[model samples]
Target chain A: MKPAQFDYADPRSVEDAVALLQQHGADAKILAGGQSLVPLLNMRLARPAVIIDVGKLRDLDYIRDDGDALVIGALTTQRSVERSELVAREHPLLAATTRYIAHPQIRNRGTFGGSIAHADPAAECPALAVALDMQITVVGPGGARVIAAADFFVTYLTTSLEQDEILTDVRVPKLTPGTGWSIQEVARRHGDFAMAGAICTLTLERGRCAAARIALFGVGAVPVRAPEAEQTIIGQEPNAALFEEAGARASAEISEPLADIHGSSEFRRHLAGVMTQRALTEAFSRAEAR
Target chain B: MTAKRDVSLTVNGVAYSASVEPRMTLVDLLRGELGLTGTHVGCEHGVCGACTILLNGQAVRSCIMLAVQADGAELMTVEGLSEDGQLHPIQQAFVGQRGLQCGFCTPGFLMSVYELLQHNPAPGDDEIKEALGGELCRCTGYQSILRSVRDAAARLRGEVPAAATEGEA
Candidate 1:
């Protein structure tokens, strides 16, 4: 299959790319790693009039530790983040999550920001962003502004980003020194989109859960935060019963979940609870280890 | 009509330049424009690894990559595996181990295994499986393919001979 015809532009600078987008408006599509966009283009699902190839923008390819957070440029490949010693040492959750994005070859070309900007509910990076409370920066005709991950994603394959805006970087805070994190997902096959997934980070203080972040993907239009579940576990000791209760609450709170050939609504809800339980258990164990 | 873009890339150590449509994928450019048909096309989407190639020393799916994106990049396709009319060690191992049935996915597997062996000369069974998992082979039940990779690793490391053993075939 071949992609539909589109005008191509290779921008050397972020400002040039944003200007191109502004000129074309919604008719333009930003090409980053092309792992996701190329497939969409080849399938003719995305028929953009113009494609702005920002993959060559060296200015946007970097990973730096800025005090409390790791600021990753939008053009940084997923493989680079996975192999980064800094990421492995500080943001182990991000490192573990990148491994689950896709097969090795795909990860070699797929970019960190592209995955988040694509906003696939089943994708690991977006879910991790939501779960970890990462900050996203976007540049447009208006100016550069930082948006919280919670506000960035509006729905599946849709984000709050404007047509003229280009995602510049993502800032993911390093995990707390004593916190435990786990990413668990269920996919029909390896490298396939997750049928249901859960990302959890837990901080235990004096034998009680001081802070917990629970997020579910493949269960809603957007990656869903389980506030009820988080509320259930905070200040409570981590235990089998508490974890099960939190998981059930997390699943129950999602009023509507996606359903298709992959799974039925009921099955997805059930899987969400199971995945959440598994993530919590694993995360608790890691907390103990820490 | 879309404007054609001029792309110059080195494929298998041979530099070639072509003016392809902006929408033309690298796999199409390789097979149609450059006549490098050793790379197969399957699923045209990125799922199938039939069109896998080495783009600047990393194995990537060419079907999803545009030819223009590879401008000035060094690429290695399946055709690059052999020299002087002799099969590459990986190819020889595949044949000796009966790793292929239809031989459609061999190029991609070879390229993938090529990179794997470069990084790790002696990968364990799980590592081998993980690397090959990116590419799909409809035949051989995967056991022989696994054996072939192990054999290739041994041969590449000089732990085993390069020639096929006697099978009375």
Candidate 2:
């Protein structure tokens, strides 16, 4: 069960890492935390001719507060972000969602940008990013460019990043005042991938929903934003009926959800509505408290 | 295929250098090259925690991490838990609490609890369960493991007599 033979290089700088990726193109794999990629390598699911080890790229591992968003370096471990007081205070939804990732050991070695870049449809971060309208930063041979979360995920286990690109960071905008957020998922076990999950965030102005964002995962090829669901509840008084209607709309919007041994498409579709309803109710309650 | 790379790492506070293949996992390095076979390899993927070890003081799956990745790094396998033949409090607590049955997964559980007690010496039942959830154990039904962690925490905090952990009684 050893990984396939491959050349390994620990790039000292981000630019050097990007340069290596450009040179190797499709033959090189970038190593961040190696929580996801190493497993793939062992399984021969991925057999890159070369591996660019970014583990020692200390510059890429950080969490900083920008004026408008929390800029997280790509190498930041999930456990560090989960235990970060700043993330907890400013982005409680992210902090909470991070705890559900895998387990303490996995999180200690899993990186934020790696998860986002992996773009697992059942993963929590992608769905949360879509709901929060986060930006994914990628550096390539051409230059640095920003890709919106919506555009970054192209399909299941595939992303919009070119073969020569490396996802460097993510920009999670700070929630505006009086905004509440929640991510709800129904995984069989505590740390398992959710069968159905929803991320809901809403800003309330004087007891009415001023803005809302709804996104669902584990129900489609890619994490989906429920525009109709968001439209149904925006600018309306938050209530059980409104939440239920929004959830129903989300369930209706997504088409042909994945079916596997985990759960049936019908079950996931049903759980989507249920999870969306619970997420909205919790998010509204939090907003009310704010 | 890439040539073997020379890697020097500190394992259990002892510095050792070896030339390892790039594909050799850290667990294989510990078991095959250095002969520290206490760290078990279960699942060979990241899912099973049998290969868990302290990489820079954080629990990580050694099976999935490359040996070359640990170059110039510090690692602690389950063998490093005790000092001078004395069982570490966690290991002693495992024996005292009957935390092992088949004993295959004990090393992983020990390292995990070692980390938990290092960070939070007074973890509640829920916290203990959450931390232990990372590894799988088919034996002991976990209640004994929970008790073992609590005992380990108490021993570390000086709440229990040191002689009690020495298996004297």
Candidate 3:
């Protein structure tokens, strides 16, 4: 399963990497951690004319605490995020979600920005990005621009990023005070892609839900935000019954759920509901504890 | 055909330089060119951890990483585990614990365990399982492998004598 022959370029800087992208357009693929892309290359599913290796862009490998937000470089490995004490203290949901990724071996090399840019429907990074409303920054010939996480992912393996743009960094806002979050997924194996998953955040004001965010993955073309389900939880006091209704709404909201050997469309739809219910239940308890 | 690129890296404590195709994976370079065949190849994709190795002290799937990408990096393969023709404590623990049947997945497991024990000398069972979650073993049902890791951790932590775990291999 060797990769097909392809020219390679090691770009030292972000501008140089963007220039190469501009030169090759879509014919070239950016090689960040190469956790996902390299496998596709090995199987010849992805035969890029050129591979622009951005591994040497050391500047884009960092985790910075920027007051209200955590600015993570696109090249920051998932393992780094998993081990970051700042993330553990400030954004526990992010820290916990990072562990739900493949495994330590893959996480050691998989870049944060690469996962978000790859936009795998079953991946936790994109769903977490959407659930937290993270901001993604991409650099191109026209300089850098930021895209809301909601607008970042367009479809399966596709993002709003232009052909010549390289995702530079992601800005994850710290969890609001009294906000509690949970991520839950069911995979065939511990490290396999989830069959279906849910990520939710709850903020309780007084005795009612003041803010609620819910996102589902592995059941659609992209990680989807369940606004209808979220609306069900926002104004109501969260209980097991309320969570069940919201889960049903979230499941119903999915117009098309992906089906494969792993699970049927109906099974995934059912799992989406179950996962949403479980995540909401856990989040509610955590919010109450806070 | 793509033009070959020059790559220089240190593997198993020795420096090596080679010219390889850009599409060549690090595992291929290690096994085919460098002759470190201890790092077996079960799946060329990243799913199987047969080609796992240490790159700059981090366990990674070498099959999914390009050889050129490993340029100027320090690496450790399964072949590097033993010292002075002596089996490493982890390998001894595997031998003692019967952690293998076919032995094809052992090398990847050993490298992964090496990294794990290096980071956490006293990892609990859950920690060991999480660290080894990527590796796939068809034989032994992973129970023996888990025992081997626990034994290896004790051996490394100086709680158990390495000689006491020596088995007839």
Model 1 docking grade: medium
lDDT of 1 by residue, A1-290 (tens): 78999999999988899899989998999998899999999999999999999978977889999999999999999999988999998888999998888888899899999999999988999999999899999998878999999999998799999999999999999888769999999987677889999999999888899999999999888898999999999999899999999999988998788899999999999999989999999999999999
Q: Cα deviation in Å at residue B166, candidate 3?
A: 13
Q: Please give me the DockQ of candidate 2 compared with the native complex.
A: 0.74
- Rank candidates by lDDT, best first: 3, 1, 2
lDDT of 1 at A145: 98
After superposing candidate 1 on the true structure, give the runs of residues whose Cα lies further than 4 Å from its correct spot.
B161-169
**Candidates in descending DockQ order:** 3, 1, 2
TM-score of the second chain for every model:
0.94, 0.93, 0.94
Model 3, which residues run further than 4 Å from truth? B161-169
Clashing pairs in 1: none
Task: For model 2, give the interface RMSD.
Answer: 1.1
The candidate maximizing DockQ is: 3
How do the residues A120-165 of candidate 2 rate in per-residue lDDT, one tens digit apiece? 9999989988988899999987789999998999999899999888
